[model samples]
Target: MTQSIFDKFQYYANLREDVARLDTNPFNVVVEQVLSETEAIVNGRRTILAGTNNYLGLTFDPRCIAAGRKALEEEGTGTTGSRMANGTYAGHLALERELADFFGLPSSIVFSTGYIANLGILSTIPGPSDVVLLDADSHASIYDGCRLGSAEVIRFRHNDPGDLDKRLKRLGTKAESALIVVEGIYSMIGDQAPLQEIVEVKRRHGAYLLVDEAHSLGVLGEHGRGLVEQAGVQEDVDFIVGTFSKSLGAIGGFCVSKWKELENVRYAMRPYIFTASSSPSIIASTRVALHILREQGAELRKRLWDNAHRLYLGLRELDFKLGPESSPVVAITLGESKEQALEIWHDLLDKGVYVNLVMPPASPGAGCLLRCSLSSAHSAVQIDAIIDAFRSLRNNILES
Candidate 1:
């Protein structure tokens, strides 16, 4: 008997059954269906959304829509080619320039997606002789990028600068050729990296630093430049990477640096060279979104924080184990039992509220999480409704 390639997928095929027993299934998003906004028909009931990461709420912005429409009309649908080929249009160049200006960096390179941005930059910048030190809680993209580089990949304790320093010291002279990567805010735990301490450690070790501002760009810093600016270590960071999918409310990614040599990587990077360039509409809308993010991010950030505080305080008061205690992203810890988490998740959905159910590897300590991502556009009433759903679930669980 021969093993089949389909056998590998058998585990996932039974994931629903496993998830049902635990009561926590992170991959399913089938509750509510809607075009936009929080209100959605979920399981045939109108539900309010809390799972989405539309942080800035620019996805439905009229200006973004208009810009995208204009580009679609002028440039057709797709670029249909790689950037190094015939895909580099005037709009692409303009967007890159705009992004460079937005970050106050001399050079910027845009990628088709945020994942590609990390992959391109990390894989191209480092080689076999180099080392990539990353936060254990870093995103999958960062890990994938390091793997693509064929470099010595090392992980430190999540958000632990001391651990990072110990690892760097262990490397000894090789630390000089290392690249330390950290996220502005870890996605799952909703906790921030101790960037100042990490930067200090990197500086002492004489290693380059790459800060992926995927979640923090347009949600942190003075003009939403990111955590590098938030930590006041803009000059210390060698490369700053960000995504448009979060606060920018678009779909793309970019890497910005003062180094002119970064431009050369455009040729060498397979991720950058082989991937189809971003569409004209995406570039146009992203450029406009970037402008809006830079200008109005402060005000929007205030509202997002306000909503986050309300939800966090509400959940904490309701006796839910919360992560970090402070951050725009709030996770309601539902203990280690996946079953309890899934029950609560289903109950929340049934009560007309939707939130992300995280479990296992995605959640820290093999814990389960009801992740709530806040946006400035969410009204206080909407947040209150979400809290009410959690409260209902808690009451039901206690009674049962």
Candidate 2:
């Protein structure tokens, strides 16, 4: 008798039981559960969304909606082929040009997704000979890119410039050819990378820096360029990668650079070359979204930050442990236990508030988190309601 390949996935299947016990299913959001106009009728109750990553609240925006509808009517739903084949549309070229102009860069390359954008650029450029130094807590896409590249993947402590310097010192002369990767704002903890210090270290080591601004784009910097510009280090970075998913409220990713040769990568990058390009509708909506983001981002940012600060203060007053204390994404830390976190999550859900319940491996320090994402669309009244819910839940837990 021989074991089958199917046996390997049994571990993952079994892990669902553990997740079930915690009432925390990272991959199990119900259909229309977090939508603006839909109901998550669990036992006949509706819930307000606090977990969704729709940061700018543009998913339901009339402008984006109208543009998408117009494009779909004019260009159909999909391109039906890879960009290397018949997939390239006029919309694609226009979007790329628009993105390049937005960044004030000479060239830009667009990918089917922000994940694929990172995957395409990082994997295609670095070879086995080149070393890829990444933050310990980089997104799975960044890690996957390095794995695909066959580059020596070296990780430093998250956002620790000194640890990065030490790692570069270990690499010695090889550091010059190394590609250092860091996120502008980490998705989980929502803390920003120390760009100035890291850039100074990279300059000393002569390393090329790639900043993934997936969560920072349309959220940071003047005109929402990203944290690189926010930190006043745009000229120091070699590549800037971002996604249109979050703040831009569209699907697709892009890499922008002043380097003329970046355009040549389109020929060799598998993720970009093999994958089908974005649809006309996505491209058009993103272009409009980018325009709006550039002109109106500061006002949105102000609203979002005010919401974040209020929520942060509210949670703190309730004595809930928070990660990073100040960030757009506020995560209520659940310490080292899962049971308590699950109880709080279930209680909050029952109270009509939906939030992300993150557990180990996905969370830093093997922790559990009730992650809340804020948006400009969230009203002060809604914020107060969220706070009141937490307060009530805290009291109930203490009494229990």
**lDDT tens per residue, model 1, 140-230:** 8998998888899999998889999999999999999899999988787678878899989988999999999998888788888878888
Q: List the residue pairs that clash in candidate 1.
A: 22-338, 22-339, 23-339, 23-342
Task: List the lowest-lDDT window of 10 residues for candidate 2.
Answer: 31-40
> Number of the top candidate by TM-score?
1
- Using alpha carbons, what is the TM-score of model 1? 0.94
Question: Per-residue lDDT of 228-338 in model 2, one digit per residue for the tens?
Answer: 989999889889999989888889999999788898888899888887789889988998888788778889888878988998999888887786657778887776666
What TM-score fits each model?
A: 0.94, 0.94
CA displacement after TM-score superposition, residue 212 of candidate 1 (Å): 0.7
Residue 260, candidate 2: alpha-carbon lDDT: 82
Off by over 4 Å in 2: 1-4, 19-26, 33-44, 395-400
